[model samples]
Target: MPRKPTKGYWVRGHFVAYGSEEDSELKRAAKWDADLSKTDLKKRSAHLQAVGEQLLTLKPSLLQGLDLPPSLREALAEAKRIDDFEGRRRQLQYVGKLMRQLDDALVATIEATLAEQHRASAAQTERLHAAEHWRERLVADDAALDAWRELEPDADWQRLRALIRQARKDAQVHPDPAPGQAQRKGRAWRELFQHVRAVLDAHESPSTVARP
Candidate 1:
């Protein structure tokens, strides 16, 4: 008797035999597509969850403009109350699910808020660094005094000179002391930082005046 016909199907010009390599490959391709689709959805969910967590970091007053759904708003509030790591994770997941049902406008709002916060933080950091640079220059170089005087003609030059002298002396006496021990020998250095920061702040905001 002739051998039973090999089980197979045709696709285009190729015959894919059952239990053959070609048939196995076809199944794998189909499964891969399904897996890829699921993976994309998972990634979207994770991204939404991250956005929700970032929104939670903002103050409630700042969130008032977003006009978020009641369910999402409540979820964010509840997430804050959940101190447990796993519980917060679950709550955030729920928030992500809710986010999927909402429009893209909410995501855009959250991103914009975060961007503004980052810009403000960067500006504050730049101000702090400028103050620190001025402090160091005033202490280490005598000519820096003239530069500062040119910038702030109304500053109490006499008092600032005295503070700088004392600060330099204090720094020499307690060079590289432990973190909190800098004030043990004298607070002159700390006072100098405060004075420089005040001067810079006043310069940045001309309406404000540096305190004596």
Candidate 2:
């Protein structure tokens, strides 16, 4: 009869223990594969390229806060000068490559700066829209003046009324252009918007005297 195989059996004359060296090797291989999948070269390069493009859109004043290296700064400048489609693309690729060598913390700072700028821009847009809405309401309805006065009692009532009247008259005299023509606002209309914006801004300012 053949010898009974033990816990450490011999496979082709070499000792093969179950769940020992073989299991360790298998685990190591799996971890290596996982690491490779996570740090895919192509994916990293693409992400860096996208970040470079976003950086290009930011104003030079804003970019000064990023404190990029001299080489990277030069790369961005060169990239900006590249007007040809393919040349710009290649320059941007080079920028991405340079970016990859930068500290991760620097990248985070750049991203945060961009995010803050976007938030500020959105807030400005909201304020402009609010001003426009108030201007339109004041011009269209006489009662809107009463509501506005209640909110801003210190406002110059005479000037505000005059502006609104002129804006309305201008709108009537220069009626909307034909469908194909570009509708352009007249001077009075623009002045009314400016006056309304100033009043709203004053109300929001801390220096303005609040009602008792």
Candidate 3:
């Protein structure tokens, strides 16, 4: 750690701890206990309090045009609830922009937070993919389909139903193929398999791990 700068609030050559005050008015409070003599502490405390309030009040306005982390800015830009209205969208955008300006040091904080989420999401996605493949192989051998059916009965049933439906439809639509030929063609089964796999893929979570 570098020595605290004697000249200004910012250390000229070092990174200070987060939320450190620029002025030393607040230092007295840290130096002495809050239960000290009221008269002695009153003057310094009052001035420091006033300065703190003023700094906070002006800080937001000052930060209004500062740049933010690109990832954070992009995330904020893309923030939209499922049922978000246009007005709410605009409000969120304005809020995000304002926040970006005020908290100049928040870029790192926001990125770190998002990185954690990304890592977790990635882990979950990996787990889901593993589950899908394991189930598929299991279904292929002994009871692979049975395992899938047990895990996701609705999805499994729907896939089977769709394949049967398509087979019937194809048989009716195209009279060229023989009766059992259409069923064995496997196009309908292949389509249903592809569709089910796609649905599983869509449910996969993206990795949120931070990269250098």
Candidate 4:
């Protein structure tokens, strides 16, 4: 015989696992440990974002003094590694968008501040126009890409892409109901089940019926 499927919280901290006093205590301890880990994860995320922001600001200054205080430098270094992995890896989707805004703002700032540095009016205008044009392309491209993603979300060009394509094909072949249809069906089924249950419960009650 096939094993029956049962659903209960299998995670350590969940209430279902702690039916007894001893189990409850163990659950509490596990919860506290998980809380600590979550706290560390959040703190690391913040620290890494701070480091990335610092890198962005620092990279802009071509001839500025480079020395950070020792403690800050240590923090920055750790932040840089974490930022590189999580920020770059997970957040690459936002890079084109962010780069567009950053480039536009930087160009405007530079044009206002460094127009005199270019020596010739034509050179300054040309550079300014180029920067603005590049910024526009970046914004437009990002928007187009985002729209395309919405229409076809499986953009990951990896081994998983084939699996995703197959799943999409299967879904197209056997499409699921729209979101609310499932909920409506579920509610109707639940009502029918409850009515059946009530009938069964009433039949099992102490009231005796006559058989003619």
lDDT of each: 0.76, 0.75, 0.46, 0.39
Q: Compared with the true structure, what per-residue lDDT tens digits does model 3 show for residues 67-161?
A: 55454334444443324677655645444433423342554444444455557667656655654454335333544556555435567575565
Q: Is candidate 1 or candidate 2 better by TM-score?
A: 2
lDDT of 4 by residue, 174-211 (tens): 55677777412233233323332333233322222111
> What TM-score should be assigned to candidate 2?
0.72
Cα displacement (angstroms), candidate 3, residue 70, comes to: 23
Rate residue 82 of model 1 by lDDT. 94
Local distance difference test, candidate 3: 0.46
Listed per candidate, the RMSD to the true structure in angstroms reads: 13.6, 13.7, 18.0, 33.1
Flag regions of model 4 displaced more than 4 Å.
1-52, 60-67, 83-212
TM-score of 1: 0.68
lDDT-better candidate, 1 vs 3: 1
Per-residue error (Å), model 3, residue 25: 23
Looking at candidate 3, the ten consecutive residues that score lowest on lDDT are 203-212
The deviation in Å at residue 203 for candidate 3 is 20
Q: lDDT by residue for model 2 over 1-212, one digit each (tens)? A: 99976575555667757676544444544554677675575676578688877888887789987889898899999988989999998899888877776666898888888888887677556667767888888889998888777657887888888888999988888889998998777788999887766665655542232211
Model 4 error, position 90 (Å): 15
Cα distance off (Å), candidate 1, residue 92: 1.3
Clashing pairs in 4: none
Instruction: Flag the better candidate by TM-score, 2 or 4.
Output: 2
Model 1 agreement with the true structure over 58-116: per-residue lDDT tens digits: 76567887888888899989998999999988998888767765556768888898778
Q: Write the number of the candidate with greater TM-score, choosing between 1 and 3.
A: 1
